[model samples]
Target: MDRQPRQSPDFLEALSARSQDIFRRLVERYLETGDPVGSRALSKMLDMQLSPASVRNVMADLEELGLIAAPHTSAGRAPTQEGLRFFVDAMLEVGTMDETERDQIARTVSGGARGGRVEDLLNEASALLSGLSHGAGMVIAAKSDMMLKHVEFVRLDPERAMAILVGQDGQVENRIIDLPPGLTASALTQASNFLARHIVGKTLKEARQSIRRQSERQRAELDEIAQRLVESGLASMIEAETSTPTLIVRGRANLIDDAMASDDLARVRQLFDEIETQKGLLELLDDAETAQGVRIFIGSENKLFSLSGSSVVLSPYKDANDKVIGILGVIGPTRLNYARIVPVVDYTAHVVSRLISKKGEL
Candidate 1:
């Protein structure tokens, strides 16, 4: 059964020190073994003079407060989603990555140090995170604010033409647009020249605004067939580039481990469905872009993973100007090793941001 809704922070603070200690031990034990923790098990781990019966009484209180639950009639108690959230926020101590982990991350990100594309760097980082965390790794590629270096139009058919945009960063993008009827090849060449003159050294958004203003004031001068082609071509290319952020995911196979497949196949299937329909994931990443540092979403805390009992740890990576550009994260079961994974994610974000800042130099 799903856990109860989250209680207020006041509820956590109201617990006695002894009760809090017991709760922390219980949650930690469950996270380690993926099973419920009995009072006998918790008593042995505690330092106080609490017997098994005393521990049982505390566990009972924790249960009534909706912090933990017994999965079966005779089984030990496990922390609910609310309990896990409390443990993560109040009791968890985040640790730094070891030398080996640092070296591995660095190697993965800089493998193409001889000058790789930004897309390649992000893909490598995602794959590395997936391998290290044993969870699905996700990355949103940074949006281009690249200035146009050149623009060309090539007619393919009677009604279609290809718009080739070369950016100042050496990145090339292409889009196909519908040609205005009764337009000649000479008109296409004029349209390409007009766009190149106006948009070179300007970002796509800047070019769009400039075109809009020119269209409004110089309507008579731009009444030719080439002007219509320029307007339609630029509009289509800008919309295609800025419509939605690109999402890259790796290590989805890790989500369906033998234990998950056998014990909770339905939840696994649901998780797969959630990944397939990535609107929820994109929205979650967008929310992370607004926040600083690592953002953790445990189970029902975010509605996207409410039924799947999943967790996501996301961090926003920035550019040279310290603007948040994209997000990267790991997704897995709620019992992921937050202490270890949090530092890995935080470090990876730092590395990615530095790489982005150096994109022009590369």
Candidate 2:
């Protein structure tokens, strides 16, 4: 469906206490087992004090109300999408991350160093989250929108030099190129001088493109040696494709486990397919930029996640300037323990924001 049908709270207000209890149990069981729950099973386990016949009748009533689904010819029932929504909004008990978990997450996200780079913080955060969540963890690096601080070139030979990038926010990246074939150290130095004269204050794409046009028009105006270095250096820079945001994902293998039954293996395979498409993954997180605290997109609530039967819990991390630099979160089955994982995801995002802010501090 392109959009989820809007559900009114009135349906919840109309449920009796016993019906609500039964609905909660069925949803919980489905989440834990990924199977339809039968009325006899509920009464046998929970001491619900209701006969199987009465429970079955109640299940029928719930099915009629659109809170549960009964697969054809099955005595058991599963929660419909509306049923999961009701459980999340009214029945689920939200929990908080304990102090110990928070402390560890804090250390890992901040890199435990007073002045570590933003890249370090994000890398560590991704690892820590994946290990803890036992699901795929993800982070998008801070965007490059800062003023240029400094630029330097390290000459390797007559033909090759390495461009060392330094951002105003303390991020660093390196671009290296082969020497055009036989230029002199003097020619390389001359090319560096040319770049310094034009490149110190612009973004990498801006600098590379501008340098290419300059070199193209005036190749004959400069010595052949300087011309070769400039041509090679700018060519190497263009090949870098450095403008796209960096995506870090870890622990994808954890998605398959004994918890997933043999018949459900197809779903696991589908999930891996989704992972290979980063554009879809980015779209899934786009709402994070506008969310306050933790945002949960349940199965099929989002198109990108529909086929995977997965849910994403994400929070946006901001830079020192209060602009959102990136997002941090986990992706797992819809059966995830939302009550517990929600706090973990929310708090980790907060820790990441603080670390990013510290790294970006002027």
Candidate 3:
């Protein structure tokens, strides 16, 4: 379970100049119109000296190069996944966002900062993203350090006690730890005093390390019962936080538009189902945005999306300390305009990082 994403393959010298031109046209046309590309149409658009028959020959050659496919006998060709990959990797030219779009995105993403909580910011960002992209937008909020605000212990049973930990950031965690065999109310008081002395103003890891060192010193008057309680309680608290997955997604309904009209309707339904079930969207984004940067998963190359005929453009958003907090991205049909959306997603992630930093400063 190495969590890092697999690296992308290096580009090889494969398609010739003419074949590249044909592939680019088919990909561009498919993305723009969501339709197949006929050779006659391409010949007229490119103003090449080739007839329909000659253009068809070149298209066949391009198909042999794994760059194009004819969906039916009489229909025009469409860019295959391999062809789309080639275009995305080398040929596609992304147009710059107009000033209007840039300002709009900035305003939209920053709207959730009224109170400046990370959760609120992420929710606003997800909703704004969905609105902007006309597809699903997702944000995986990263867990931050808990600044301790308070702690209390409740005796749930003679053999169990619950540690209620509250953080300055307004998050709460409750962990149940087994009581020592001979533990009593007096022992609980002594344990709370001993533990609070070590836990306050320190992170869970820091507290654990400090407690471990203190217990190992084995002072003669040390409260053995209290030390064991603190140790078990700390371990349980850490495990509880790690096991909880926090993810936010919006705009799934946006996918049911005309762009997804392929023979894979059932498959699309399954993909939507997966998105709503397990944290599939987060998992896919986590797997792709590996280098602390943006990554594009096109068509069959992404296992989660193989049957869905979809593409995911993901970017890693960082926290104030410059650590990758989570990933953000758009998911849509494979014919999506990767050229346009890649830069948009990348810029959006950057904006999110900047906004988080600003909010932290506040």
Candidate 4:
């Protein structure tokens, strides 16, 4: 879906208390059952005395304002994508999770992290939110900005070599790189030695820049074949790192369970198929990371999930210094319970931040 302008506050302000209450009830019921709601049903649900005809008239005004729409000619009305955004922005009432829910999350994250890596803790967060929300859960595995301790090239095959990067914290990552044609064992050794000599102690990005500058100055002194190998190893690894930050996804089956119709199931399947390659969704999470708190992207508001008509609720986790490092959230149909999930995402980030602070101080 193409981006539409954000909903104006004027629309909400113009609505009467009755109109707002009726709209609120409609959304609540739709969220509960994933079905369109008729005016007769809404009429009975309203606390005030109003006939079904009166309720339908109010719904007509809402539809005209682009907040609601009838999905079928005969069926009742459902919130439009715009209506969901409007509700989320203006009408949603968020509540703190009770002690039981909080304990569940705490147990899941804390139990999973007992003497485990921070990555494992965050991965547990993904599974926790997916299980709670019944949606696809995800966490953006922040790239290690820790300074590099060592970098080496190991030949795995005649055609390819692996670039292994070890960080100061002892975290290691390996990227497979294509070998330059006719490259020799001696050239590989020279390249590895040059990288360890110059690129060690720099972040991956800094190491990349360092290679370019040092290579230019030492071109005449450096072996030509070794230079090619060094460039290839750094370039390949950096490209791979940027294109695919480790996105930990869990509980995709919940999406199928959430599907309400054949078309809904098909869209969920499309989402399942494309989600593996959705490198673009990172940009949306990046926006959330830079923001102050929890962020919500309704259907079509973010282009990557527009096709599936899904919503995302994201919060960035921080480290000891409270710097936002990575994002955690759930993706499901636009009708997801935003009020319930928003606080969960927010508190989960807090939990993760505390976990990191403890480990960092240790």
Candidate 5:
């Protein structure tokens, strides 16, 4: 049931006020309980006096317009994806978190008055969103722009070695690279020293360019194995940079029911399988964002989100200069409360960007 939504919500304006009111109530109740709303339920929820028969006639018209559908052979109806989209874009009101809630978000991300490393701040924000929203939270962070304090290579085995990169601000990260045949401890030492010489106080991208310019003259300065190790370690560092930003996901259990209801388990399984192959998920984060910063992608017309039957509320967090260095958001079933979660995600991103800006000032 991965149906497509209409391109625009303008058609929603043509519905009579009676039809629109019924549709809104129907969608609201369905989102509230994750179940269909019957005509009797709609009649009670409505402010004006309306008969069940009148509501049923309106529901039939809504069904024909592709706004709502019956999930089973029953009188109850649920909002279609298109219906939800229209309600969000047109009829829904975005709710605001109370002052206490906003303060909690600020304190959680900033680690209480003082800020931590960029990595720690992002992880904290992800956990906070998951706990508050009751959904899996994700953060995609870029490391290419960060300055380096030290970089080293350690041989794990004959065929593999590790590259550990330490940021100037005490952020430590490591990546594994393949070792060339017949290499020795001397080569590892040579590679580590070579990178330390050129990579000090330079970003991975800058270091690569700096080292390559000196390669021809430095060629006679080191053995062939050492040169390869230097290039390999540096390449791995940059390759592990922005294009492969570190993905932090938390509260996956919130999405998986403990009872493991058959239908719920099936959707959870599908979601896990797509996340395990994260290419589509990463791409979705990259493509997610609007002039307003927060963008919502529901099921269908997307990669991981479509197959998982999930929706993502994503926003990009920027650096001191306002460059989009990463993304953060919530992921859960389509039945999530968009009115509530959207504002939380938007505010959390704001807090993260503010903390990063303040960290840069320090």
Candidate 6:
């Protein structure tokens, strides 16, 4: 799906104070109860001395402007997607997490899972977000090239060997390569030592460039066997690193409840299909990386969630150099509690970035 730019909030200037208050309250009530809000119900909540009849007239004006509509043949109203977007952009007051919530996020993302691998930490984060928000949690892992710490080649058979790479972040990866004819144990040692000496602190991309330059110059004083092993080994490792990006999703069960499964099976099925494909979801997150803070995609605002009538709250996390590398977020019904979930998503992104910044130390 094509990405859409965020709508401007200029239209909010047209709404009067009373109209804004009524719209905000109606959206809040619908979000809390998932029910259409009636004029009488709003009259009771507002301190003004307006009667239900007076409120009905205002509701008619709102409906005329396409901000709200009567879902049935009743006086009750529900916010349209446009209305929800307006409320979120103009009137939503983001709340801070309490002590309990702060502790929960810290423990899940960092403290309790101390010294865990980056992948495991991200998995924990997804599960924690799902549990807290009662939604499906997702994380797009950073696929950026890592600083090399160590490299080794172990022989498997006469024609195969395993290239083991250890990054400064304690990330270990292995790639099996088809050996060139008549490669010796001494040649493998020479290749490993050559990589350690030349590229220990450089990123994979930089290391690859350096190796290519050395091979072209033929001035590194290496034997034919050793040079070939270095060429093949580093080429294989670079190919593996540049493969498709990684996506981690947890607590999909949270997306289905007994009530929702029985009442709206079609929507539930569509949600599952979207999650299974994940291409569209990844595209949406890729767009989020351009923005500075948390981004909210409500209902049809994002085509991926259009059919499912769902919403997403996403934020991009950066590395120590402040480069955005990945995204983390949650997905749920459009009526999700934005006041609470927004802070959770924002804070979680902060925690993930902090952990990534300390990767070299670990």
Please report the candidate that would top lDDT against the real structure. Answer: 4
Which model is ahead, 3 or 6, in terms of lDDT? 6
Q: For residues 154-254, write the lDDT of model 2, one tens digit per residue.
A: 87655556787676656677777777676666666777777666667776567767766664455455577677666667666655633456778777777
Question: 8, model 3: CA deviation in Å?
Answer: 8.4
Q: How many residue pairs clash in each candidate?
A: 0, 2, 0, 0, 0, 0
Q: Where is model 3 more than 4 Å wrong at Cα?
A: 1-16, 72-74, 151-165, 172-201, 210-229, 243-245, 257-260, 273-292
- Candidate 5: where is the Cα deviation over 4 Å? 1-6, 112-115, 215-219, 258-262, 289-291
lDDT of 3 at 103: 82
Off by over 4 Å in 4: 1-9, 146-151, 157-159, 166-170, 190-202, 205-224, 260-263
Q: Kindly report which residue pairs in candidate 1 clash with one another.
A: none
lDDT of 4 by residue, 1-362 (tens): 01123454566677999999999999999988888999999999999999999999999999998999998774699999888888887788887788998888888898757854666788899999898888888888666565778988899988898888887656678888999888888888888887888766787778878667763667655588788777777777777776765678898888887785525788887676667776466685577565777878887777777777789888887888877778888998888898888898888888887887777731
**Preferred candidate (lDDT higher): 4 or 5:** 4
Question: For model 6, what is the error of residue 349's alpha carbon versus the real structure, in angstroms, after optimal superposition?
Answer: 1.5
lDDT of 3 by residue, 286-353 (tens): 55445555677877776766767778777788768877777878888878776677678877887788
Who wins the TM-score comparison?
5
Residue-wise C-alpha lDDT for candidate 1, range 1-362, written one tens digit per residue: 11122344655667999999999988888877777888898999999988999999999999998899998775699988878888887788788677888888987888744454667778888988898889888887555666788989999999999999887766787889999999898888878877888888898779878878874565454547888888788788877776656778889888888336438767767877766676565576567666768878898777767778788887888888888778888888888888778888888888888887887533
How displaced is residue 331 in candidate 6, in Å? 1.1
In candidate 3, what residue range of length 10 has the lowest lDDT sum?
1-10
**RMSD per model, one decimal:** 4.6, 5.7, 4.9, 4.2, 3.6, 4.8
Q: Score each candidate by Cα lDDT.
A: 0.79, 0.71, 0.71, 0.80, 0.79, 0.78
Better candidate number, 2 or 6, judged by lDDT: 6
Itemize residue pairs with steric clashes in candidate 2.
159-179, 160-179
Better of 2 and 4 by TM-score: 4
lDDT for residue 309 in candidate 3, whole number 0-100:
71
